[model samples]
Target: MAQFDVSLVLPDTLYHGSTMGAIQGLRIKPINKEFWKDAKDFGAGFYTTIDLFQATTWARKPVVAMERLNKGTDPSAMVRSLPKDQIPVVAVYDCNSNLYTDNIILHDYRGESRAWAQFILSHRHSSTVDNCLCLNEFGWIHPHIACGLMADNDTGQIIEDFRSQGRDIHNRDDLEWFWTQIIRTREGRRLNGLELGDQIAFSAKL
Candidate 1:
């Protein structure tokens, strides 16, 4: 599996403590200090943000606060319950955001290739990411190249077939151009075999 870094940013000067103070003004029992302490000690927990808000016995208040936040309301009550002035920081390791789809090959290297394809298809993919890191160009491609299982025909065909069927294939142009360039420039490198099969199968199945 590929490893990645995950991070988030919260405005440092936002009204975090302000929201908590608002809650107190309403005579609502103060939320557990542990929650605030946790945010203070470790920014917000990625997994727990929604959970924490949901768990608060006061539902309407949190909802209103969140709505305010959504509407660009300033210093809403919910923000008060959170750590306001300080930016909570958390370091996530081995983060990933891959997703899979129906008809995607899931066996052998094919599964991995499909996953990688899905990732690059995302609008946020890093174009600068390449095989090697530096001078000698050794290990230029990520050692964990999930190029998908060895395919036989042009890889671009699968994307083309997907588009023909009216499915909004992700990264269609980028991947097509990338492979086109690779095939054009490389002396003998070819697209993966299963990818070609995928195209053929998709065409027949469709």
Candidate 2:
């Protein structure tokens, strides 16, 4: 089993006390699949980033903006209105990759191969393509993992544009080209694997 020792950082500035409480209490749960389905890029699962800066941005997202974004409404203003704080704490975990054997799907977009790009587009645009089915066909749903093309305003807009246009409206070459550029600097990673404990170590506020 590939073992990973990683840290999940939650910014107190972005989340309410109760939300932080939940994380501290180990009560945080993955977003439900139904709601996650419409979520940009990969459907719902616990999301994390190896980059602390990226994670800090996620943790600092305002609740109202998050709600609006999830509802497909533009929340650019709301996002800008949110205050940035430095009170971020990290939750560390030791993960057993073996536990992900039948449960995890990796999108290794960092490579030159176009496979990850194709899979992302197909998963996003194909009405008949069920991510659950994709997971099951490969194995079982231990969890969800998206390696490349980190979700952000630019990438999110790309996804929205393609989704609004419908898969057939755009040429595959253009889509493939766009994705190739997006994943160029992305890293190979996974999320929601089997965590060994409820509480590992929490980093002091950064």
TM agreement with the true structure for every prediction? 0.18, 0.46
Candidate 2 local distance difference test against the native: 0.40
Candidate 1 stretches with Cα past 4 Å from truth are 1-114, 120-148, 170-206
Q: Cα deviation in Å at residue 97, candidate 1?
A: 27
Which consecutive 10 residues in model 1 have the weakest lDDT in total?
197-206
Summarize candidate 1's per-residue lDDT along 1-206 as a digit string, tens digits: 66545332221211111233344422342223223322110111111111222223222444454665578656444445555432122211221223312333111223324433433233112222222221232123222112222232333454445556555534566555434432321345554443222211010111
lDDT by residue (tens digit), candidate 2, 1-206: 67755542332221212134335343344222322333334443444444445444555555644665578655655555445432334433334444433523343344334554554454455423133334433343412445544432245556667666554414767667556444433342322222100111111110
| TM-score quality measure for candidate 2 | 0.46
Error of 2 at 107 (Å): 4.7
- Prediction-by-prediction clash tally: 15, 1
